[model samples]
Target: MKVEGIAAIVTGGASGLGLATAQALAGAGAKVALVDLNEQGAKAAAEPLGGIGIGCDVSDAASAEAAVARAAEAHGPARILINCAGVATPGRIVGKNGPLDLSVYSRVIAINLIGTFNMMRLVAAAAQSLDPLDGGERGVIVSTASVAAYEGQVGQAAYASSKAGIVGLTLPAAREFAPVGIRVCAIAPGIFETPMLLGLPQDVQDSLGRSVPFPSRLGKPEEYADLVMSIIRNPMLNGETIRLDGAIRMQPR
Candidate 1:
């Protein structure tokens, strides 16, 4: 679907990759909605872009529904749904303090895996009702996976599993939405210069950057946005999880 004049929603839009995508969509003339747990920050982020910002817990049915409803009221139902809301609370399944707490594992799954699905189902439902666009396409959904899903290092069991769920979800979701002319795809990014990572010491960040075989630096949020824009523009791309890593396969740490 064309980004210009289309409605788009990006979760985790307060900062990081989500924000970058929202920026790109807005720049492309899409009516954008920024959704995040940080309500104030989301509002601020969306204001300059002429988009609306909403506070929502992507894991909760009621909250997500309300958020989607609000976005529809403001900019019509979103045809482009980008799933970037997630938590990366690293923890081992078995740790020095015995098994990791059940809460830790459950929280990660709830927010990262279930959250992506929650937004997808709602957005796809809305998009399906709209008349097909050029090329019979109704909508597009691009979610964020992680290279950790394939090569999860130590202390990432929960994070890895949640991302793996995203990878597993791609093909099935694309097949299910095929009849409706809605495309589903995902991007599995490696180490990137997200706000979470930026908080680390400069030397530590540099060391992490050096680990990548080429470019030898952290991926930029804007680079990820470029990939999303490409996927949205290409109708032939569907049911696949494309890696945005700098050709780096992580080692078990």
Candidate 2:
């Protein structure tokens, strides 16, 4: 996990938290692979990082497999896999217009929940085959959830459920991978100044930031990357979902 000369794969690496993580990993001398649905965006993001950019749909098993394969071909078997590919679709099971669209709910789950799992399993399989590094650590896998998983506000049924599934998955995955010297951890972030949150009105974004207890501001993508670096360094921190929420428990909206 020193990162120097190691291979890493960062999903959703074209933008936001994943992009920041990719930058951090590359800066730390890791051979990085940037995977995203937006091939052009991935290319742009990977160019300066000196990492390979791979077009991938995390929800598709074949796509995930191929992406992992290509990354291995380019950078050797990856020992660090970060799962940041997710979609945030806000919807209520029962809305003002009655029941919500079933398709919307399904799509959110497919992209956010299943997509994380698809990439994790595929990447972990590849990592498992690699020989252990220092401290018998073969690899580390970091995934992204959301504070919504714990304190979902109104109209966050689909999004919250998908994130909660990710939170639930961490411990089991870590436990399962323990024998292989692989670690699985997740970060449940609060409101951050990513494209998703920034899309809201400025006032809305300001209010959301103020909701955080101490910082009273939104998180930066680089801050998320810093915690990821810590997780990579500290081998004891496994099977846990650390909240990067700055002490915010969302209120019912």
How much lDDT does each candidate structure score?
A: 0.97, 0.93
Model 2 per-residue lDDT tens digits across residues 1-253 = 6889999999999999999999999999999999999989998999999999999999898998999999999999999999898887777779789999999999889888999999889888888988889899999999999999999888899899999999999999999999999999999999898988888899999988888997999999999999999999999999999999899999988
User: Best candidate per lDDT, number?
Assistant: 1
Per residue, candidate 1 scores C-alpha lDDT tens digits across 117-206 of: 999999999999999998999999999999999999999999999999999999999999999999999999999999999999999999
TM-score computed on alpha carbons, candidate 1: 0.99
Cα RMSD for predicted model 1:
0.5
Deviation from native of the Cα of residue 21 in model 1, angstroms = 0.3
Off by over 4 Å in 1: none
In angstroms, give how far residue 136 of model 2 lies from its true place.
0.4
Q: What TM-score would each prediction reach against the true structure?
A: 0.99, 0.98
Error of 2 at 165 (Å): 0.5
